[model samples]
Target: MTSPQILIATLVAAYLYVVTPGPAFLALFTLAASRGRKSGAWFICGHLIGDVVWGALAVAALVGANRLGPTLFEALGFACGLYLVYLGVRALMTRKDALPRTIGAERPLATGMAFGLTNPKSYPVALAMFSAIVAPYIGALKAADAPQMFVAAFLGFLLADATLIFTAGLPAVRKFFLTHGVAVTRVVGVIFIVFGARSIVDAAQGAMRKTA
Candidate 1:
């Protein structure tokens, strides 16, 4: 049976891995700027939902699929790169003040779906996470514990993602900063560029890694 201590440790490690800045967080920040905190909260909710779904998919793939299959994985990466560039261009061209408060929850929901559907960089990392950490520990737990463990792991991931998304909502605090300038908008554009570039590089390297 997997040791209880080991299970806890695995969960902790998974939590840490998702906390890093990535396309998902960048998307949340971009949405937060245009939508406000209410929107930011929705974004966080959606981001976590995406993370949980992707994390679970990685876990399943690691068990059966080619966790590192270059052909399939690179396709996913390429799709994500194109999407991020589209998102970046939108941010680059959009006027910060042009966003209407009436945007409602649809924006955040779309961000969440886009994040889940397009972001692939995290999949490899999560595949490793589940195999190296979660597997051994979860292996030890009672069969009855599987559902509880899944719920707990999802929550842990949710907490980490929520923290980042909420922080993106921070600049909305002071009206002076919120209405006075485009610095936040510009910063979001830069963040999107970083995500777009990283995704492209990862897709390219996947091919090289396979051919070499």
Candidate 2:
């Protein structure tokens, strides 16, 4: 099992990443804003189901780590770290007005599920979080232990996403968030950069240990 501090850090980072505005948020926002919270809940269910698949993939990668050797894990850390830094920079550079704000249809559940499944970012986000934060402590637990962490992470995402969708359905709240979206995104970008740097350091340390 991971130390309590790492576990808390992983959960916090996961929540922050999930809440950052992106394709998933836009999709949910459109649906919730157009339809209602009830529709949004169904949409969130679909999204959660898609996230389950992502969580499974993360666990699979961790399990595979045991066999592929430490070098592979180090390489993965570096790759995910660089990717995080790239995403952070991109988020920081992009203006809020440049993003899409299309309205949604009545069939929110199906569309939401489709969006969740098709959105390319989910897998990479999962990989980055797992590689940067979870990988170091994964060895302490049995391979079977991965599911619990996945479930916990998914619940956190679901709660945060559901709340956001519900709140965004309200015109005033949505307006406030959208108005301040740039500030929120900047904070998230900084957090991502910090995590990315940590991952790079961890990768370097792992490589050095292997060389030694």
Candidate 3:
């Protein structure tokens, strides 16, 4: 594949990866529904940091230059899992008459950054997604191409972020969230707990594997 082709492939892969529903999607939707597009935008901005970091790492790994150890990521996964479970519990315990405050509405940027950086699945998912789409071109890729590929991926992230912002801010969507905020919060909470538990289990398994 040529440079342009590789960049386009990376962009498409990144876009698809971001749009796939997961913790970040759930959190973004919740924030946009509860707050507004501006809040969602801020969250996306913060999340971009993680996206870039993980994207770069994925590219590095793909290029046979990965030097980062698995231990650091495993520890981060454990911590992130615990934090997610804590947030889920808080959401689950929200009063019916009260607004849900577990999603860090007051500090959306930080919350988003935390969500993005600490997501245990981010690195592997990114790697898998990129590999699935861009692996065919790996033989054609060169060291100089990494930066351009990353730039394309960044553009993809921005596009997906815009899509989420628009979708979350739609009047009907906002109205639905407003009408059933409590239920939605609880439901999201349950999902978060499940994700957290899965992350915890995966991290533990990874640790055990390492020990053995």
The root-mean-square deviation over C-alpha atoms between each candidate and the true structure, in angstroms, is: 7.7, 3.3, 7.3
Please estimate how well model 2 matches the true structure, expressed as its whole-model Cα lDDT: 0.67
lDDT of 2 at 45: 71
Between candidates 1 and 2, name the one with more favorable lDDT.
2
lDDT of 2 by residue, 1-212 (tens): 54565445446545655666656765566555556667767776777767767756865676577566777777877888888888788767868675445343666678768877877878877777767767667456456555666656666676677667667678775565546656656666776677778788888998897789
Show where candidate 1 strays beyond 4 Å: 61-106, 131-148, 172-212
lDDT of 3 at 86: 73
Please tell me which model should have the higher TM-score, number 1 or number 3: 3
By summed lDDT, the worst window of 10 consecutive residues in model 3 runs over 64-73
Give the range of the ten consecutive residues with the poorest summed lDDT in model 1: 132-141
Q: Write the per-residue lDDT of candidate 3 for residues 87-121, one digit (tens) a residue.
A: 67877887899653437588889988988899887
Give the TM-score comparing model 3 with the true structure, all chains together. 0.65
lDDT by residue (1-212, candidate 1, tens digit) is 43567446546645754664345544555556666767767766666666777676654553332334446545655565566566556666767564323333577766666666566655654554444344334224444444444565676686776666666668644343346335555554555556556656766775786789
Measured against the true structure, the TM-scores of the candidates, in listed sequence, are 0.51, 0.78, 0.65
Which of candidates 1 and 2 reaches a greater TM-score?
2
